[model samples]
Target chain A: GAGVSQTPSNKVTEKGKYVELRCDPISGHTALYWYRQSLGQGPEFLIYFQGTGAADDSGLPNDRFFAVRPEGSVSTLKIQRTERGDSAVYLCASSLELAGGGNTQYFGPGTRLTVL
Target chain B: AQSVSQHNHHVILSEAASLELGCNYSYGGTVNLFWYVQYPGQHLQLLLKYFSGDPLVKGIKGFEAEFIKSKFSFNLRKPSVQWSDTAEYFCAVSGYSGAGSYQLTFGKGTKLSVIP
Candidate 1:
């Protein structure tokens, strides 16, 4: 089976521009999550989706950052007025189901977003 | 309100040497613990997890972690290491929110270098 995958392995954009990152989770996975990893740091949670609805979005830094999983399979993270501070690796993960405390998330090769 | 801590930022060891990476978390409720590894230029991979029952959990590549509830710790260990083990190891914790959702909090990763 194909693992989780992300498009545009690398993206370079000017500050204040709009950017969108895509993610394709594994087949049959109903829980999807988004994270951001900065240099020399661990991944920071951004958002999580259960089915077609976002279960928890408290991790989102601000209103400029939004994500959607319209069909409950693929997800897209959108950033409006991107800032240089937003430059980091965007990661996506998915799991078989939301099992309270036992679900194991499989991650994708992150999309490195560079904001100049 | 939830946070994870990785005591070691970097470690160097030789082949056949024992390995230990310290991890501690601060959360008031029941939590799930995990260890993830990311090789250079590779996606993050799950090494192990602890949900319940046994405190000691084993993972792939001869890795293991012991969950100590009283100490609020889940430390990763291996009897011997190989050159291939050089990578970044992350400690993450997900708390059961009682609302059917789990959000992960990751620590600053530890970079392990194994000399051949």
Candidate 2:
């Protein structure tokens, strides 16, 4: 079985541009999450989806960040008006959505976004 | 709000030396604790987790952690570390919030530099 994967391993964009990061979770995982990691810092939670709906999105920094998983398989994280402060590695993770199940997330190779 | 603390931001150790990385979390109600690791250029991988029962948990690569509820601590330990073990370690906590959602809150991360 393939692990979780993200596309466009590296992306460079100018400030105020828009970028989208894609994540393909493992087959049958019903839970997906996004996170951001800055240099010398740990990953910060961004948002989470359970099935086709976002169950938790409070971690999203602002309205400029949005994500969708319409078919309940793949997820895309979209960032609008990217700022230099937005430069960081974006990470995606997934896990089974079992009731009372302790979520053990499996991560994908992050997309390093550089806002110049 | 939930939070995690990694007491050591960076630690240096020699090969075969005993290793311990401290972690503490603050959250109310039921919780899940996790230790994740990232090798150079690699995605984050689960080292172990503690949800319920058995305070002592063992994970891959000769790693283990003891969960002490009273102290709100889950510390990672390895008796003999290899140079390959040099990497970053993260401690995270997850608990249910309102709206039937849960999000992982992570610490600042600990960078372990193992010298061979």
Model 2 error, position A87 (Å): 0.7
- What's every prediction's RMSD, in angstroms? 1.1, 1.0
- Model 2 root mean square deviation, Cα atoms: 1.0
The list of candidate 2 runs beyond 4 A from truth reads none
CAPRI-style docking class of model 2 based on DockQ: medium
In model 2, the clashing pairs are none
Tens digits of per-residue lDDT, candidate 1, A23-111, equal 99999999999999999999998999999999888889999999999999999999999999999999999997745568999999999
Highest lDDT: which candidate? 1
Residue B109 shift from truth in candidate 2, angstroms: 0.8
- Strongest candidate by DockQ: 1
| Candidate DockQ scores, in order | 0.78, 0.73
TM-score of each candidate?
0.97, 0.97
Worst 10 residues of 2 chain B by lDDT: B96-105
